[model samples]
Target: MISKAEAKHIWVLAEQKKGKVANVALEAIGLARKLASASSQEVWAVLLGQDVGGLAEGLIQSGADVVLVVEHPKLDTFRDDPYVDVLAHLAENHKPAVFLIGANSAGRSLAPRLATKLRAGLAADCVELSWDAGNLVAVRPMYGGNVLATVTCPEARPQMATLRPKASPRPVLDASRKGRVEKVDLGGLQIRDRVKLLESVETGGGEVKLEEADIIVSGGRGMGGPERFAVVKALADAFKGAMGASRAAVDAGWVPYAHQVGQTGKTVSPKVYIACGISGAIQHLAGMRSSEIIVAINKNPDAPIFKVATFGIAGDLFEVVPLLTEAVKKEMS
Candidate 1:
């Protein structure tokens, strides 16, 4: 256990893949900047990957005071052991006061491992974060989106938490910012090569990554069938947004599983989420209730989705979607 006096800088695990930095890192950095300011501390980013040095500039501009680079050819593709080994070593030495991670697939796996190794308290999938009484408070949905729970790691020296992607506003880019980038050597580190990644196929084809989209047009069981998703696609295309589907839609084979958004699928915090013909089940709201704006279009006026929506259109989506799509295109023209 580390003492409060011994704990220093706020460290954000700058998760990246194949050299491109994950967008969530920027949001985490933005939050770290706020948390660090309260304590008059520094925000340090720990980037782990091969050939990731080029990304240091972007991280620095995004609000990190220092970027710690861990480069290794073995890290080109994410391997559990090597990554855990390197980060565990850093935490052992630096003892950061707060550690933030993106709550993505890789981060979900890494945070728990590091938290266990460091014996730190961890709050996962936090939608909000702030300092209260000198403790970092993490707020996340609980009871299947029925309520929010605020968690705190008061006794832990290095408080650990994972922020859902886009939980915080994106940090403004300041190219004028200057920061230090230090390359750390991972020598004498014994890594257990138990898992091997033989083949990695990219999903989404040419479609936009659902989680990264600023706007999403999604459909549900009310959309009728797979062929009817064309209207949903048109609305999505009209907005230059991504296409999404509720679990019922995916389970019904109306769309691929990749487009699913719900408790069992991807969590999206887009600028705008248009729910077309979705009944707004609690499971689905848990994934996207954090969106900046929600427009619910459902035939049922009492659909639960309208509860969290910024705008509600209680009308037949069959008639609404095409007219809405035409209006958007006409305005753009």
Candidate 2:
């Protein structure tokens, strides 16, 4: 526990999309609450976006003791310059013991920059976070998911970490819990960058992000061709899960980058992950190795995916997936 003389708080950078709170924000707050309790500190959430007042209530309900809202018209959409500048300023001002962000696209882009600006150590894609006698310890995968590394930022103030989405449990709603809302003014420090968002295109039915999905059905090179994705999609549909792909498939242009799951792609921690026709490269396992249950289906019995799979089927995925999908559909009906 931190000494009484040293004040400590858990600060989470709450993310918003289309003026609404992102699910990753809630998950971060939930994990922050747990870390706060262990360190005998308070959990505070910081929101940066235009007209973000509506998001404060949800943050409180998600276990934040105080919601620090930084509302600026420039923050309405995600721009790297303004968001990073504001977050760095807030971290310096608040001087929280620990600062956390989601390991999603936005967070991944901003976290390392914020850490550089603050001159603080940061552990990225952390699956677990805890306080070891007042020192913030972050647990992250290393060596292509072959080993787990526990890191500590004892020398840095506002010890920073980014948690992978779905790596932690979602926070329970506590409607009765009340929290303070402090609004920060972002005045002259806004920096303009060259990148500008002209238009945003939504894809894949805008389904739940693979990182946040409870169930994911992933395809690989062995899937044969992009057309064969239908078999994988059918299984995902039957399970109401999101579809994903190995980096090999994405690089081969067999699937969109959004669907890729590997070291170079999205980190996911789903309840159940079904890998179809995937050999499970080390880079790919780095992303989804934390899944609660991994099911692998591949024609090759010697595929590397079977090593990490909780259940393995040594058969053609094309044959197996359709049968499994039909069985699931029948059960659901």
lDDT by candidate, in order shown: 0.89, 0.86
State each candidate's clash count: 0, 0
What TM-score would candidate 1 get against the native? 0.94
TM-score of 2: 0.92
Off by over 4 Å in 1: none
Candidate 1, 88-162: lDDT as tens digits: 888877888899998888888988988887888999989899986678899987766678999999787689999
lDDT of 2 by residue, 1-333 (tens): 222234369999889989777787789899999989897889999998888888899899999999999888778788788888888877766677888998878898999988898887899988888878878889988876788899998766778898888877888999999999998876677566557789988887778678778899999999888899999988998988899999889989989998999898877889999999889888899888989999999998999999999999999788889999999999988
TM-score of each: 0.94, 0.92
Q: lDDT, candidate 1, residue 183? A: 91
Lowest lDDT sum, 10 consecutive residues, model 1, at 185-194
Q: Which residue pairs collide in model 2, if any?
A: none
